[model samples]
Target: MALLLTFGSYSALDGGSRPLEGNALDGAVHEAGFDHARVGEAWWVLLPVVRNRSGADVEVLDVRVLDLPAGLRAERYAAFDAEETGAPFLMVRDGGPEFPSGRYADRSGRPVRLEPGEVSRVYPAVKVRVTGEVLGEPSACRFTYARGADRFTQVLPCGFTLRLAA
Candidate 1:
């Protein structure tokens, strides 16, 4: 039992983030295209999957976008199990089947827990409603999680630049 406890503690302490292969979007700036005429239209800006490589479980506390540009507002954020639902950008829509049902209740004051070797996709969607041309530097998607009693934050450079299309 002592050995088992030590192993569990070691696994929990070894927790961190890993980039998904073929979808390594870190440091890549994606352009969020929005209609200039159509203001107040919301769109989902999805981030790449975050994988937990530890041997123990980790609880994701919060997810947010850092350094958002003017006119681009983050209305809400969510995390979904990548294995069950696939890509959130493709599966999630305003009136789609997965919009209101398939998402994990991470934002409902409950942290999403990920088992060892699990991958989850984070979405911090932006609401576009600007009169002038909106262009800004790349922003980052940050994820805060806890392993056992220790807290850690992983900042993924899933940058985004706003572009208004005619």
Candidate 2:
């Protein structure tokens, strides 16, 4: 079983709630039971899923976690694997999307184009580490992607929560 956290659905703050045209892409982060995560742990599981929710196809350049809480590191994986005896799991990696100048045009990786009504495969799991900070309260994960001429970020409420150790 899995517990998913959704902080809330929101467009890029700069856009000021402009209607998403072309069924803009919105997403959620899937995690294991929230209680299993504790403050001070170095890592937490994150499964990112992006959906094309508009009437037209949406081009997804890259999907990565942005605006991660301070002292937390963002790591991304390309796929998840299952073993014969172990539970289904993802091979976690270090680092998230790094672009020069924070400009949308500087993006270089292969872009993924999702047709309307399509969802991305959850693989190469994404995990965040609490490098430093007092994070007993739930932190936040802002999932951002580039589509067409726009970059949209949606933070699902309670979608990724960090708990204090008992």
- Candidate that scores best on lDDT: 1
- Winning model by TM-score: 1
Candidate 1 lDDT by residue in tens digits, 10-73: 2223334532112111223345433332344454555534555667776656556777776566
Q: What's the TM-score of each model vs. the native? A: 0.59, 0.47
lDDT of 1 at 145: 57
User: Runs in model 2 with CA error above 4 Å?
Assistant: 1-23, 29-44, 62-71, 75-108, 122-125, 130-134, 137-140, 161-166
lDDT of each: 0.46, 0.41
RMSD in Å for all candidates:
8.8, 9.8
Q: In candidate 1, which residue ranges exceed 4 Å CA deviation? A: 1-37, 80-86, 90-108, 121-132
Candidate 2 per-residue C-alpha lDDT over 1-166 given as tens digits, one digit per residue, 9 for 90 to 100: 1111112223443564442322254555455434343444544354455566665545443334444556556643233222321333322222223211222221224355556666644322345655555354333434444444455545433335444345
After TM-score superposition, the amount by which residue 141's alpha carbon in candidate 1 deviates from its true location, in angstroms, is 1.5
TM-score quality measure for candidate 1:
0.59
